[model samples]
Target: MICLVGAGPRGLAVLERLCANHAGENELVIHVVDPFPPGSGRIWREQQSPQLLMNTVSSQVSQFTDESIDCSGPIRPGPSLHGWLQSHDSDADQGRRGPDDYPSRRLYGRYLRWVFDRVVADAPDTVRVVVHRATAVALEDADNGQCVTLDDGNRLAGMDAVVLSLGHSDTELTGKERQLAGFAERHGLRYFPPANPADLDFDKIDAGEAVGVRGLGLAFFDVLALVMEGRGGRFVPSDKGLRYRPSGREPTLYAGAHHGIPDYARGRNQKGVAGKHRPRFLTADAAHRIRENPEATFRRDVWPLLDAEVRTVYYQALVAQRGGSSAASNFLKDYLSEPDDPGTLRRHGLTASDEWSWERLGQPWRPHEFSDHATFNQWLLGHLREDIGHAEVGNVDDPVKAALDVIRDLHKEIRLAIDRSGVIGSSYRDEVIHWFTPLSTLFSAGPPPLRVEQMAALIECGLLQVVGPEPQVRTDPTGACFLIGSATIPGKQIRTTSLIEARIPKPDLKHSANPLLCFLVETGQCRPYHIPDPDGAYESGGLDVTPRPYRLIDAAGVPHSRRFAYGPPTESVFWFLNETIRPGIGSMILEDADAISRAALTC
Candidate 1:
């Protein structure tokens, strides 16, 4: 018997591969365990409100292996999310969703369920799949093989191997977060720690209450939708753009982050599902050469190549927009010969204003200081409007968006240069993890363009306000409320009794709140991955595992022969852990799953 823990997308991928590689001679019993439904698991469970939508378009997501995935196992072609919706008439309302439209999370959950059912129905006769609706709280070595204990007090014994595909999990609060929580509890205020937004109770916040939100990433967008639209407020088209119609049930929200701006809206999907930007500078061969150097750092080596890739795409689009295809070709030829020369661009009729830099784009607010909140707010609003305009122009047509989208497209090459000892230890900790990861995420992983449009409308209607850059949140004991201020805007602060942390907790194995993870650590079944730097070691807060099959490394530095782990839980071991499988791209998730399945079966 083989046991699969956490039946989310990662676990589902393993099951698909197990069947695909099955020899069909011996009987195979697979036990799938999770408290939530098998396919959707916790976060993507069908119970979420329909207002919460997926960040990816429907045509891009898939649950099955396809021709694009390079794996040793046999490919099992299946429908993409859009294709599945087209066939399922019962989902007529959602079935009519266009390829480019974002589907509700609940609808995606339904699709996951259908995919799970389909995988089971098509499994070979030799394979028998049993799903348990209970969490696997503990695992231990048994006399025969291994044993998994469920939350329901049942035990599945004599398992040949087990795979832990635990996705996003909650972690204990940090020192600052705990202090804030204590303050809120003492004063009868509401403090929401980092969490899945769908699980938060937004209704508990009183109407017209002043609420301070402490993150401006994707989670903040979800909170905005829930507290506004979910509370009966509506957004309608106006002469200028969108106008908010208040239901008087919305909270006055002040949201901000280090950058003091919402994430950039995703560029419009002019490229189809299979469309991709071919990298010229940041190619795999280039990355491999960088990996050969012992002194390589992301800033010193990788960023130059990545920057060139972005500039190449940006100027290609910009020149094409101005002087058409033939001009773009000539510009590319000259630009390739002298990538750093400004003369090449000027020769193509481009000015200094046309130059692109990732640093300026990533931290646009750095060069100026706002005297007060009003000045910052106006400046921010203009930035949002400009971002929306570029988004509307589409990723393919817009020069800026096309350039920024390179960060998304060249992720595989990026991973090749940074994941698992690709760079020096100090460089990995400081340059790659601390600096580059967040910057890339902010630039590439943003909400739908429509969401940003609604955000601008909310700000115009006075329902939402953004605190200035590098915001600091503190407990104002004198006022018995939370105070949020920005270092950039001195003497300006917003006070509120309700404070919501609109972000997910970073994965920390040492302080994981989940009983299963805690048990694993306490029992020495696993340990947290640590990154060594010249100064000191940085705790990665990810489960340490072997490279290929990803066997969980024990506390004593030994890989467990019969155990494996992947997905978000093994994030530091693998770069870019949170993305779903795209149909026509080579998927790391699928590759990892196939390797683990083959290893598990052989064991």
Candidate 2:
């Protein structure tokens, strides 16, 4: 019997690959384990509020393999999530949804569940798929194989293979968070620690109380939705933009980030062109170069090509949008002159900043000063309106938007470089993962544009406020309230009775609160992933995995063939593995899954 832990989307992808590889095999029995639903998992579970919507468009989501995809295994061409929903005669609501529409996460969760069920039904009679609705708490090496201990004190042994597809873990309060918690308890202040935004209880804070929020990402959007619309406020169409009609039930929210940068509003989806972009410079040749040379750094070798790709796309879009214009001609001349140089692009006024200062994605303007909250709200409202306008025009017509789209599409190539070099423990990898990745995400993978417009309306109505460019939070000495201040707006600090951190913590096995992960580390079944720094110093934090087939590397510096891992924990090995699995060229998730499944078949 084979075992798959944490039956989320990643797990399902791995399982599907296995089924394809081992179809009609009578002796195979796969035991799937997770406390949450198998396919949707915890984050995308159906229980989430409908207000929470998917960032990706409907047509982009699929659980089945398609003909266009060149999978190493069997190609099972099936309907995408949107196509499947449209095919069903019973679901008229889902049928009416189009390719470009961003559906509610709840509805998408249902589709995932349906996909999981379909996979099970289509499996060969010989392949027994047993799903256990219990958490796998621990795994120990046994005389025969690995023994998996469930949360209920039951153990299953003699597993031929184990796929660790564990999804995002709950964040444990760290240094400042722990201190804040203690301060909250002592002072009777409210402290909502890092959690799934949907799971938050809004009733904890009163209507008029000021609440400080940390981070400005997708989670922050959910928090904003809950704090505003969930409290009986409504966003209506208006001449200026969306106008908010408040029920006066929301607490005054103050939000800011380190850079005081909000996520770039998502651009309009080009329905038919998902995964269609092909990189010219960031090709297989570039990947091989990284693999051949141990001295290669991502920033030095790979970023130029990635940056050039974006510049090329941006210039192309500009030329197309302003055909025959002098501006377009100038852009084309500069772009063609040095096709692969960012300095050339910058000199020729091809940068996003050069094209349009305010429309630039992910680059925050500094020292945002407002005489009062009202003035700050007005500026924020205007900023959102401008961003929404860019989105409405679509990326092809919007040069800044097109550049952001190009950067987003480079995820595959970037992942390829990471895979080729295995830059996990290096300082360059650290810089890329910590700085570059987040910047790319903000520019490319932000919320749907409509959400930003709605948020503007909320700000206009005083429910939300941009308190600072980068706000720092500290508990009061007397333990009465939380003090939030920004360096940008010095001497201007706000005291709030409550504070909530609206961001997910990175996966670190050493500090993981999950019982299974903790047990795995304690028992020497797995060790924290580490790689050498530029000076040849090794660092650890990421979950360790063998180079190929992704077997879990044990404490004794050995790879266990019967075990494998993918997704978030394996980020150091597979840098961009923290996304939904899709059937596309250079899709590491699919590629890794195929490799793991092939290994499983042999074992």
Write down the worst ten-residue block by lDDT for model 1.
Answer: 88-97
Model 1 whole-model lDDT (C-alpha atoms):
0.88
Best by TM-score: 1
Residue 57, model 1, lDDT: 92
Off by over 4 Å in 2: 68-70, 89-96, 271-275, 324-334, 339-364, 367-374, 420-424, 538-540, 583-586
Give a tens-digit lDDT track for model 2, residues 1-603.
889998878888888888888855467889999998988888888887767887877777777665555457887666776786687643323533778777777777787788789888988777889989998899877889878999987788998788898978764679888998889888888988887888778788899899999977788998988877777888889888889888878788888776565687877876363555578778767876765766667777777777777767777776667554666767667767777566765664455445433223443444355665456656667777788888998866677677788766767667667663445347445667677777776778788887888778777777777765668887777777998866665456789999998887777788887888888889898887666556764544578888768898898989998898878876665665556645433455666677888898776
| TM-score, predicted candidate 1 vs. hidden true structure | 0.97
- Summarize candidate 1's per-residue lDDT along 1-603 as a digit string, tens digits: 999999999999999899899995899999999999988888889988777888899998888888888899999999988998888865433533789888888888888899899889999999999999998889999899899999999999999999999999999999999999999988999999999999888888999999999899999999998999999999999889999999999999988888778888899999899788998888999889998986678899999989888889999999999999999999999999998899999999999888886667877877778778877777788889999999999999999999888899888999998777677778877787788888887888999988999989998899998887788898896848999878777665888989999998878899898889999999998998876555666667789998898998999999999899999987776677889888888888898899999999999
Give residue 89's error in model 2 in angstroms.
6.5
Q: Tell me the whole-model lDDT of each prediction, alpha carbons only.
A: 0.88, 0.75
Best by lDDT: 1
